[model samples]
Target: MDAETLEIRTIEVTPNAAGDASTLPDLLAQVPADERITRVGGDGAYDTSKCRAAIAARGADAVIPMRRGGQPWTTDAPGVDARNETLRAMKRLGRTIWKEWSGYHRRSLIETKMRCFKLLGERVASRSFDRQITELKVRAAVLNCFSQIATPHTIRVA
Candidate 1:
């Protein structure tokens, strides 16, 4: 998702049991190559080396939290190394403060969309895989339209 625009740039529908870390590469691949991505923020599940590598390849910072006792991968990717440094700083600054400083809270934009989806309908109306995919795409489009119309734009003079 584009944090600034609050737009869903990519969506990968995976099975319920699929690990987020394992699916990072597929999701990252969906991001357009031309897009200028500065940082990729995710929850602790995305702190693995593969995800870090993909983020580094895009020349972006991985604003993901390390798991408990999670050590940095021994590699030369600057972004990965920077993530490790962030882990160290997290220990000093505390996770909550670090999240505030790093703009991790913006991740809630996607969460808000999820909430909207749930509010609109909790269950998939279509049972078939292909039909379900089409249904979700249409639902996302409808949600985006609703968001565009309902979201108030405010200009800050400060």
Candidate 2:
């Protein structure tokens, strides 16, 4: 999701068996290579090494909060240093303060957008996987259109 535009930049409809963290890499891969991604934000569920590594691979800062009682990674992995640094910051500043400092609250906007998406239709009418994907994409497009129309354009006058 694009924070500035409130658009669904990419969407992936995975099977129920696939976990959010596990499917994150595939979602990140869908993003065009040329697009510059500065930050990837998500809930604690996305704090896994795989998700962090995927974000790091795209050269984006991970804004995912660590899970409660999470331990630092013992391996020398691509995202280990950043994740550990975030963990240390969380420990030092405290979770609430760290979240405020890191702008984690911006994630709530995405969550609200998702809720609105779900409100459009909780269940997809299509039975086939391909159709389901198309259905979701169409819904997202419609939502994006609505967001674009509703958003106000403001100018500052001195």
Candidate 3:
């Protein structure tokens, strides 16, 4: 989701067998290479090495929270530094303060968008997987249109 527009920029529908975190890389890949991604925010489920690496590859800060009782990655990997720093900060400032400082609460915007998407329908009407993917994409487009329409316009008077 694009934070500024609150629109789904990329959509990938996977089978029920696939984990949500596993799709993070593909979603990032779908983004145009030239586009500048400043930050990627997600839940603790996205705290995996692969997800972190993908976000780092895009030159974006990962706003994913560490898992409960999670330890620092043992390997001196490329992405571990940022995760370790987050861990240290979380330990020092406490989770609530760290989250506020990191702007992690922006994740709630994504959650609200999902709730609006669910309002369209809880389940896809299509029976086949291919059709289901198309259905979901169409729904996302509708939501994006709704977002564009609902956005308020303002002007400077002074």
Candidate 4:
């Protein structure tokens, strides 16, 4: 990210975040239990009951994929092997809607939001961690406070 007021700062490298239930709990401890988290999308990495419980505790609707050797989300659904085969052969236009399709559609929306936040908010190229967080919060607060000024209908440049 770009530095403060476009000022450059020394970078500090941290270890890659760890995985597993214990790791998740420790890392997310700062997040309040009552915070209204809507949805959490995760991969096979989140398999343990503790992971699920922790997410659900935040009142979030989790969309984590059940890991291999773990309980299936739906017993009637075909195996991953078959699903992979279908995904490889089918095109988006003619293919039937499936679980992967749902995930892709939803994930794309999230990607768009992040891209907009990065571009319009000048948040993508941050100088440091604290600056990055500040930029995001500042952008959101500014937008909320001056929503009408930002809206196309009310914007009349003199």
Candidate 5:
């Protein structure tokens, strides 16, 4: 998402406190502790100790990769040994994804979706935080509805 429109965040931002990072933890607190979340995938910025510990407390696996320059912990977990093999396989798969010679590339499909949102000419006429949030929700809802309409259905006559 562009800096102008949306920030990619795991937390939802209400209009009252949009664009404010200070409100995130308080918003997170409002979510019940008992609710079970499975794997959470995010970039390393969400790698704060508190966030990690909280996820562990809830019995959820954090799919987050370890950040650089940290002490590597040694633990014997199943499927953990496959990392080296996966990197080897990535060499082959990564080449085709780039359409030429290979180097690891971040997937751009999510960025493409964000670009589509911007291109849709969604109304951002009001700079007021409430209006921006209201428009964001409407845009998301409309996008989902359009996906439902655009999906093809197949029928077979007996």
Candidate 6:
């Protein structure tokens, strides 16, 4: 989703056994080839080579943070060198500052969307797989509409 607009761009429904890292490549594929994405942000859970590679393959900066006690990448993978550079920055500038510099904080925008989804309802009412997906899509659409309608109009007071 766009950070400013909160408009969803990709939706992938994977089985429980598949971790987020595994589904990332598929999710990234949903982005239009012509679109120029600047950054892809995720929590520490996505701080793996596969996820990083998927982001780098799309020519976007990975805003994911390394986990505690995380080691710098030693391989020549797509995003490993950049990850190592980020690790060094984290070491020198500290985690908080590095996160700020890297725009990792934007990850919370998705979290806010999740929170709104939960607020609508935690459990899917539909029993069938296709129906459940449809339900989720409908919910996402509603939330997006609500977000648009609720956006404040700034009136400058002299």
lDDT of each: 0.80, 0.93, 0.93, 0.45, 0.47, 0.86
Give the per-residue lDDT digits (tens) of candidate 1, residues 1-158: 66766666676666688887888778788888897789888999888777888888888888888788877666776466788798888888988998898888888887887788778787788988788867877777777778778878999998
Total backbone clashes of candidate 5, pairs 3 or more residues apart or in separate chains: 0
Supply every candidate's count of residue pairs whose N, Cα or C atoms clash at under 3 angstroms: 0, 0, 0, 4, 0, 0
Clash list (residue pairs), candidate 2: none
- The TM-score of candidate 3 is 0.97
CA displacement after TM-score superposition, residue 40 of candidate 4 (Å):
2.6
* Clash pairs, model 6 backbone: none
lDDT of 6 by residue, 1-158 (tens): 77877877777776678788788888889899999888888888889889999899899988888899989877888999888888889999999999889887887887888798789998889998899888888888888899989888899999
Quote the lDDT for 1 in model 1.
Answer: 67
Weakest ten-residue segment in model 2 by summed lDDT: 4-13
**What's the distance in Å from true for residue 87, model 3?**
0.4
Model 1 lDDT at residue 70: 74
Which of the predicted structures, 1 or 6, would earn the higher lDDT when compared with the native? 6
Local accuracy of candidate 2 as per-residue lDDT tens digits, 78-129: 8899999999999999999999999999988999999999999999999999
lDDT of 5 by residue, 1-158 (tens): 21222333233446544443344345445557775555433344544455555555555554433344433334444323332333344354552552222221232444555576677674576688777767776776665566557657789999
Worst 10 residues of 1 by lDDT: 5-14
Q: CA shift at 56, candidate 3, in angstroms?
A: 0.8
**Cα miss at 46, model 1 (Å)?**
0.6
Judge candidate 6 against the unseen true structure and give its global Cα lDDT, from 0 to 1.
0.86
The alpha-carbon lDDT assigned to residue 57 of candidate 5 equals 55
C-alpha lDDT of candidate 3 relative to the true structure: 0.93
Stronger candidate by lDDT (4 vs 5): 5
* lDDT score at residue 82, model 4, on the 0-100 scale: 29
Question: Is candidate 1 or 2 superior in lDDT?
Answer: 2
Candidate 4 local lDDT, residue 57: 61
At residue 34, give the lDDT of candidate 6. Answer: 95
Better candidate by TM-score, 3 or 6: 3
What candidate 1 gets wrong by more than 4 Å, as runs, is: 155-158
Query: In candidate 4, which residue pairs clash?
Result: 1-125, 1-126, 2-125, 4-7
